[model samples]
Target chain A: MAENYQHIQTAHCENGVVTGLLKHQGLDFMTEPLAFGLGSGLFYIHIPFLKVSGGPAISFRTVPGAIFKRTCKALQIEVVRKKFSNELLAQQFLDEKIAQGIPVGCQVGVFHLSYFPKEYRFHFNAHNIIVYGKENDTYNISDPVMETVTTLTIEELKRVRFAQGVLAPKGHLYYPKSIENFDKKLIQRGIVKGIKRTVNDMLHIPAPIVGISGIRFTANKVKKLRAKLGIKQGGLFLGQIVRMQEEIGTGGGGFRFLYAAFLEEAAEYLQDDRLIPISEQITKAGDLWRSSAVQMAGIYKGRITEQKDFDDAANMLYEIAEVEKTAFKQLEKLKFNS
Target chain B: MEKKDIPQDTSPLKNMTREVYYVKNSDGKYETGLSAGWVVKNEALENAWEDINEQVRAAKQAVLTGEKSPIYYYFVLQLMDYNVLSGYTGFWKFSIKKHMTSKGFKKLSDQKIEIYAKVFNITVDELKNFNH
Candidate 1:
């Protein structure tokens, strides 16, 4: 069976407290009272109408009085729930919105999470598919009313990348090479937190190998989804995204495994041995990586499952990375013309 | 039971009206007057007040009484053109009412087109005609 994890937490708001489950960074789990408003038994964050929103954290509730009555805000805490799924949380959230006129748009997508090893799937039935096999994974996930799901394969999901550069087409938003170049820089600079350097970093690899570029494209596609009715770009927003990288020569503990895979995949230029054992395949995940991409694509379509599933995929990838050196030689000879 | 001329769009409480006259098609021009109504009625839409009332009441009563189906009042509001104000369900009724009319529709429609043009850096004509 695939690996998984779940976290549930109970929050106390003015309207009362409810237990919620969250996987990723956001507060996606359902609240108590199952209602939407602070007054509706459910504790909901009080927000304004079209008020300018800041980045990852929007600061509000600073306002006092009636405006703060049932005011609510979502905070990320470990999930403590024993039961949470689409049939429960999904429908509950939908009903709450319709009844109270929350109208935060309809369910756009679903993202399933797994723990321990870490993996993700974007479609709703992804859990079922993995457990039951793809035999009966028949459902039009693209329906306007239902959300699409996405998946992740590793411990840490590479944020999606975009194409943008000098060679980028007129209408094309991002340049592929430029984006790849950026990922290489991240590896080259290399002093990263909570991550180790890999072969990709030593050789200075690109994105398609490591998976960030695919993510950017996936996010873009999610934007095109009609059901989500994606939010409008508030205004000309610009900020720096800071990423720490380790020094190239001192490829110590910090050099990331993802980078290593990139370097090995790029070794096609020479007669030297590339792909190592499936075990040492951590630097860059291969077919497993592709399947994760498919999973992520499914995520863009809006399906997500439990944390253990995400972890299983990640652990599998890590295992693929730890494989033997002789296997690498065999893989190197297997030229993929793609 | 057919309701009288769609009840002049007497929708319930709301904060922001998604129906704030934005165009859904790639064309970038809001469909105003009767065209907008037709789009909402058949293609896709949240049930309007009259719709909500009848559907909600009947469904609730039937659920309570264990009936097969509620008294489905299939009303015809196509001739009423009251759906132009359908967006008022989630917005401030007083303010949205002032803007959901003839002149208000044109002004908001133009502004909506202009907004997209600004973001995508295309022409107004391109935005409007593009959705087609």
Candidate 2:
């Protein structure tokens, strides 16, 4: 019982799933940037005390499922979500949904997904994918991050769905029950609110390890780590930051670029000239952030050894924090007449 | 931070297939294209692999020394920590940690062994023998 599901690869997983599932429900095609923006996905946090997969926690975007949940709310879509305590029951329920011609969104652990490259596979548990159909014992998977539709055995799928870890999926499945049609007015309001929210959080958040302050805090932590951990171990820690930036989802400076892309799209949609320069500003900030990663990587690879070199990398990030601060403040002034 | 400083060595990620990355292009436009394998990315992943391998190696050594059980070795090799293993087997974290020791593993009830086997995707006999 396989439906004709179109597979669209995206830079990030959750937005891609939102775009794909919305399209599958006969809704208008949603661009990745639109989904990301409407979902209010731009965020930053660097919690040094918290550890994830053995490294200090550094997150570029909002938590997983935030975009989907926010975007669905903004779009006025009603969705049905379920989580199964039993693996067999989960599998059976998924089969029934497919038989009923509904494409289901699921959260799974990336570690057990057989199609992922071994180097990319970790114990990360919040990865999203869609199961649109089943043939024999194989489930057709539309993994948003992958280039095309793939197949996984039921046993393999179950293992990934029920993988135990931080943020375990527990066989979670979701599908939209009804999609209400909306026009450009709703999109404009969503964009305005999204930009305002980003500005407020980044500029006004009291937590030192969140928003623009978090970037600066991370820089200070990195400089201190260079002194305490020494070169070899410190380099690994620096590399973990780079990994958090580049390897995870569309991270590294990629989230900044995505946000910038959203601004570009929002500018065209609203015909607002103010957003164009802000988009350009954010793009430059993203570039500086990437430069910081590159410099950190230089230290990580032993190409740069001096403490000054590490300081310079941290300084670049500090500069980006300032750049983002200015750009987002301008975004806060955006007004929608709708 | 310049491009010239990026190390060109790709040996660390030789086992991995090259994948596409959707990144911003030079003109500040988004482009979905294959990444020119950067040494830093490979180094980061290599660091993670090293951590996992280090734990697995230590677990194997402990098992051989009769200090810990073979279940301890497989638990790590399967990429599970004690907390995750506890969640899967419905045991407390302290109890799971205790079961990692040889003496405690030997004292496990048959039902507990079966539960561990199911969670580990192994048969009960395999869980019992746990031949590396």
Candidate 3:
């Protein structure tokens, strides 16, 4: 039997999957921004030693499953998550869950998902989607990134669930078993706590490769890419940053814009007008980040190699760091209505 | 990129769903948008694909010359770097690297081969005779 599952496309995967799953549980429908904000999805990290697709790692969001897990914890929602070592067992469990009328959110590799664009397929295994029903050999998919619902064969589904690489899905599955109407007061508290945690992460993390420091740290390395990695490798490395920011997880602007959207919605919900301007500040900062990626894309395409352009892009990051520092500090000091 | 500046990749190979990107507009807001295959974003992706393709091509060339083992080709096909493959297979990076060479690959014990085949999601026979 095909269970009724709503397919709502959103900019990011995990948050969208969470939103869809939560709504399917008869809980008040949640927006993607709210899910992201409650989950504290905003983050930044640039690991110089860790290579992703032949270039250093540059990530804009919290690690995979962090948002969904944290948001569920904060809301005190009854949810269950599991990781399977045996592919057959995982499929069996999924079938059992669907037979029980539960729509399960699954972590999958994007490379083998037949619905994805051919060019977009990579070894990224952290993509999240919903498996609501199974009809013979086909599983009904509610992939949050796709514009519409799709179906996958049992073999194709198994391949993606068992895909190997960093952050492999490991046939991970999660779903809410029980949900009640969320209290507005509790939601407000969750939002405020999420904001405080994000602010601290952006400003307080002592690691040089995380938070605002990481931005500047990456900028410094980017400036020396030509000298350190040589011309061709440096160009490719720079291109990897563009791919990470724009193509991978980001809807655009390295997820700063999405965070900005969350903040804007937060402002309205919290009834704190101050958050509106802070949201705009973050949006402006997101613009600058996008500009840097745009300039780096130019560098990758061999259009601009001038040190000045690289310098300008690095300088733009420095400026964004400053803007974020100020905005987050403002957010930290913000008072929510009790 | 300007709407007009986006590349018009009319090639039959272009995949519409993959080519589309979420981009920021002039007003500093992001919207799901399409890119002409020639944009810098697409170029970056193309560069990644090229690197992945090169690994596969090099593995095939090495197999043809009998310079490396079929394991090397499968490793690349699995989208794994040496470090990742080593970590999953419980072998040192150097050991994995050594196994890639024709001589070392031929000397593999069944236990080691079983571990590798399991990691790669292939049968032992498939790992041994991976001409395809």
Off by over 4 Å in 1: A1-284, A290-310, A317-338, B1-132
Candidate 2 stretches with Cα past 4 Å from truth are B1-31, B122-132
Interface RMSD, model 2, angstroms: 3.4
Give the docking tier of candidate 3. acceptable
Runs in model 3 deviating more than 4 A are: B1-38, B60-67, B83-95, B109-132
Candidate models: Cα lDDT each = 0.23, 0.79, 0.79
Q: A211-253 in candidate 3: lDDT tens per residue?
A: 8898889889888886677656777888887777776446566
lDDT of 1: 0.23
Evaluate residue A128 in candidate 2 and report its C-alpha lDDT on the 0 to 100 scale.
95
lDDT tens digits by residue: candidate 2, A1-338: 54788988776889888999988777664778888888878888998677665666898888888898888877778888999999999999999999998889999998878887777777788999999999999999988876668889998999999988789999998988755555547777787777777787788889999999998998898777778888877777777787877764463364887788788888888888788899888878877877787798788778888989888888888899899988987777666665
Q: Which digits, one per residue and each the tens of the lDDT, describe model 3 over residues B1-132?
A: 323333455432254232334444676443446443445567778777777888899888998798988889988876777656864687988999889888898899999999999887789998887666
Residue by residue across A1-338, what tens digits does model 1's lDDT show?
Answer: 01221222111121111221111112332222121122222001212222111211111111111111221221212121112222334334333432432211111112222321111111211011111001122211111110122233321111111111111111111000101112222211221110112222211235322223222322232333333332211100000000001111001111223223323333322233433333244323323433433332222223443333334434443443334123333443444322
Calculate each model's fnat, 2 decimals: 0.00, 0.33, 0.33
Tell me how far the alpha carbon of residue B7 in candidate 1 is from the true structure, in angstroms, after superposition. 56
Candidate 2 TM-score to native = 0.91
Per-residue error at A273 for model 2, in Å?
Answer: 1.6
Question: Each model's TM-score?
Answer: 0.19, 0.91, 0.87
How does candidate 1 fare on TM-score? 0.19
